[model samples]
Target: MLEIKDLHAYYGKSHVLQGVNFEVGEGEIVSLLGRNGVGRSTTCKAIMGLVAPHGSVRFQGEDLGRLKSHQVARKGIGYVPEDRLIFSGLTTRENLQMGIQKMGAEALWTLDDAYRLFPRLQERADVKAEMLSGGEQQMLTMCRTLMGNPKLIMIDEPTEGLAPQIVTQVGDFLLEIAAKGISILLVEQRLSIAMRVSHRVYVMGHGQIVFEGTPADLEANEAVRKEWLEV
Candidate 1:
């Protein structure tokens, strides 16, 4: 559903993403896997129009490079950054309410669906977002983005630095998302989750995709793993 070709991004002359290329098929989970600073996050930002893209970003046959970030989102792409961006002052339910593109608009995701995915959100529905724990904040962020009812969701490091149990929960959540016919472009470093949940994986290095294969292909190729993935 999303295709990026020859994508490049710069931070005032510092080239971050260099001719990155990939595609996320409809209802498929594609993981962008690499270590820190290899430009995975920049790929998402460039696609989302947060960064000025120097190449083609096409979604559902529409060119997205000329669009602004909000415009890109309105095109049905949801982005959940690594940093959990939430309204600290708003109640959990209120924050979720803000993600609705339009009240009672027909969409695949809803507040009820979000609550079913993470029941803890319902338990803390009345609490301020700032008062939640780290994992809770992460869940809230993902759910709030879901409230937008995106056709595709690009999540950056959804399981970063959380407890193992929570990490597992996040993995299950990803599976559930894919089951709902939503394409997912997941930027994840955790190999187990990526391998388990992703239909295909791309290994990036020095701001370009160096490897692309199924989870089994990745597991069998120790050389590629050691070169681009293993730390």
Candidate 2:
């Protein structure tokens, strides 16, 4: 559903994503794993057109390198940023309403669908987003993106700073979403979370994809794990 080839991005003069390449097939869950500051986030930002990148970014065979961020979003791409940026003042329902786009009659996600995926959100439907706990906030962030009805959703660090039980819930939610035919591009630091949720994984180091394979393949290859992921 999405492909990036020879991707290079920069922040000012510092090169971030250098010759990065990867792909996410339809209904597939692909995790991008890396430690802090390895350009994992930058790659997502570039794909969403939030950062300037000098490389090929194709979504469903359409070139997306020059499109603006919202344009990319309109082209069936949803993004849940690392920082779950819920409106402090808006109610949970209101925050979700902000993601609705007026394009298709067959909406990909509705209130019912979101509630089914995250029942806690339904319980707090009328509450302000800021009053929710960290796990609730993360769930809300993912739901907000899903409301846009994206064919491919890119989630950044969904389990960061959450309790273990909540992390497990989020992992199950992602797996369910993938089961429903939503292609997922997951950027996560938690290896276990990535391993549990993704069908395939890509290990990034020094701004490039050094390893790409099944989660089982990653676990079996101790050398790549130690070389790219060990602290």
Candidate 3:
């Protein structure tokens, strides 16, 4: 489980995340939704320790407020950024291989599992990552993190620029990941996919959580959507 309370982050004097609070239970999918500049991504960065954080960020009851990004990762928190970072020169197989732990405990996913989720990855397994399409790159990015065997994965915009069909594929993948017992914290711009895959949704505005509830509860609240989510 992961817990964040009164979480705040700053870029010099510019405050980004202000008093954000939320929790992601084991095997549950939680979506963080809001318009641009509402701090949804900042919350992910803060939780991943990519930025300096002030306030509590605990995972499995251990405090990680002061930990570095890599340290946080070592503690089982994987991050898949919106940029879909991958080694351009590396083959798809090599990129995926990079994520697998050569030692330590066993991971919950494998290249075979990733191939099953996204067959394109398997098709281009020996091809350089740079040769893959945008959707394929995103799939690779996510699978690479899964290779890390995280208890909780904070994914920022998994379906951002993909086609509608790819979006559906990614949404199904998120659901499958949860079914396999990996907690997901998805920062999504697409509310439809989020609602379909998540157990609950949290809407953020001006750097704070303005709404938190189940999908049905969110659907019934049009005012919240108008103010914090709808563009």
Candidate 4:
């Protein structure tokens, strides 16, 4: 339901995303995979309008070229940043409440669903956000964004800096989200995790998409894996 064509982004004189193009269909999990500095994160920022972008960012056939970040979000796009931007001062429940939006009569997600998905969130519902563990904080951040009931969510490096077990949990969480019919554009560096959860994967290098295909296609292409993905 989201399409980007000839998308270019800049940081002053430095150009980071050069004609990056991709699409995320409804209820599909598409992973944007690449090593650091290839502009995977920058692509998320550009799509969210956090960075200035030139060219087309069309969501549901509407152009988002001139819309501000908040405006882009209002159009049913949720962005979960790499840093896990949670409100340290607010309680977990309060943080979830902050992301609430007016929904159509057919809203698919709710606080109840979040609690059901991650029982830890419900257990710590009243605890201050900063008091939670790193994994818990990450869960809170993703759940909080779900409170908005977005059509598509862009998650940037959701498993970064977390323990292996927690990384597995995050992968399971992503699968659960996808199961509920939400489109996802996941910016993940971990190939195994991306392959496990993504329906299709796009490998990027030098600020451009070098390869795009299904997870099985990626597995069979050792050269592409070595050249663009393997560290």
Candidate 5:
């Protein structure tokens, strides 16, 4: 459902994405993997039109490169930033309400659906977001994004800084979302999480995609892993 070609982006002359190219099919979970500072986050920003990019981004055949961030969002792309930036002072219910797009009620995700996916959110409806644990915060973040009813969700580092049990929960949640036909573009530092959840993987290094394959393919190819991912 998403295609990026010859994508080039920069942060004030420091080139970040150099001719990066990839695609995510409808209902597919694709992982964009790499070590720190390899342009994984920049790729997400460029797709959302948060950065100026000299390339083509086609989402469901619409030219995305020319659209603004809000415009792109309106076209059914939701972004959950890496930081899980929940409003600390707001109640969990209130924080989720912020993700409700201006669009009408016909949108795919509803408050009921979000609560169904995350029962904890429903239980803590009146609790302040800041009082939640790290895992709860991440669940709140994901549920908040789902409230937008996006066709494709770009999740950056959803498992970062969470306990292993929470990581597993997040992975299961992603799988559930995918089963409901939501295409996911996942950026993750944890290779195991990505491998378990992603149908395909794209490895980036030095601001470009150097490898693209299935999880097993990536595992067998030690050279690429060692060069691009190994610490």
Candidate 6:
């Protein structure tokens, strides 16, 4: 239920996202794929309002362009940046607790739910976040955002720098998220996981969408992969 139209963003004089357009339907997993320096991350930042946007970003029919990042989160959108912004000093459990958006409001996700998704989090419940391994930290970051019970979550490069086994866990987690009816706008570099989990994929190039299709459709288009996705 997220729609971005004619989106554009700049870093001083440099234009990062130019006339970008896409939408994420309810409970759908949409992946934004491209090689490095192609504005994939910038698109996420612009939609989250961390970057100044020059076009329309609408969520469930409401304009998000003018809103602040926290404001956007409150409007049922959660963002997990590529950096995995976890609280280094907080305990694993405490870091998860920090993601609680509503005290008593009914949420689709809970602490126990998060623990069940990844038992390692429960095992190290009392450990500080900084002490966790890279994969564990990534899992923590994602589960923390889910605590907000977002209608749509935009995760930027969820599998980056993790071990292959951890990457598979992340993929399973994405499927579980979609099974629970949460929409996902996944910005990923790893095509295997993205292709496996995404209902549709969008390939970006030079700050624009170059290809939009189902996973099967994308798999059949070798040229698109060679030009925009493959290194």
Clashes of 2: 0
Clashes of 6: 0
Q: What lDDT, from 0 to 1, does candidate 6 have?
A: 0.95
Alpha-carbon runs more than 4 Å astray in model 1:
103-105
Question: RMSD per prediction, one decimal?
Answer: 0.9, 1.3, 1.2, 1.2, 1.5, 0.8
Per-residue lDDT of 116-137 in model 5, one digit per residue for the tens? 8778889998999999988899
Error of 2 at 5 (Å): 0.3
Assess the local accuracy of residue 100 in candidate 5 as a C-alpha lDDT between 0 and 100: 87
Deviating ranges (above 4 Å) for candidate 3: 102-105
lDDT of 6 by residue, 1-231 (tens): 899999999999999998999999999999999999999999999999999999999999999999999999999999999999899999999999999986555878999999999999999999999999999999999999999999999999999999999999999999999999999999999999999999999999999999999999999999999988877
**lDDT (CA) per prediction:** 0.94, 0.92, 0.92, 0.92, 0.93, 0.95
- 80-180: candidate 4 lDDT, tens digit per residue: 99999899999999999898885556667778888998899999999999999999999999999988888999999998888999999999989998898
- Model 5 regions lying over 4 Å from their true place: 102-105
As a whole number from 0 to 100, the lDDT of residue 172 in candidate 5 is 92
lDDT per residue (tens digit) for residues 1-231 in model 1: 899999999999899998999999999999999999999999999999998999999999999999999999999999999998999999999999999885565767888888998999999999999999999999999999988989999999999989999999999999999899999999999999999999999999999999999999999999999999888
Q: What stretches of model 4 exceed 4 Å from their correct place?
A: 103-105
- The ten-residue window of minimal lDDT in model 2 covers 99-108
For candidate 4, what is the total of clashing residue pairs?
0
Q: Which candidate, 1 or 2, has the higher TM-score?
A: 1
Give model 6's TM-score versus the native structure: 0.98
For each candidate, give its TM-score against the true structure: 0.98, 0.97, 0.97, 0.97, 0.95, 0.98
Worst 10 residues of 6 by lDDT: 100-109
Q: Per-residue lDDT of 108-221 in model 2, one digit per residue for the tens?
A: 778888888888899999999999999999998898888888999999999999999999998999988998899999999899999988889999999999999999999999
- Score residue 122 of candidate 6 by CA lDDT: 100
lDDT of model 3 at position 74: 93
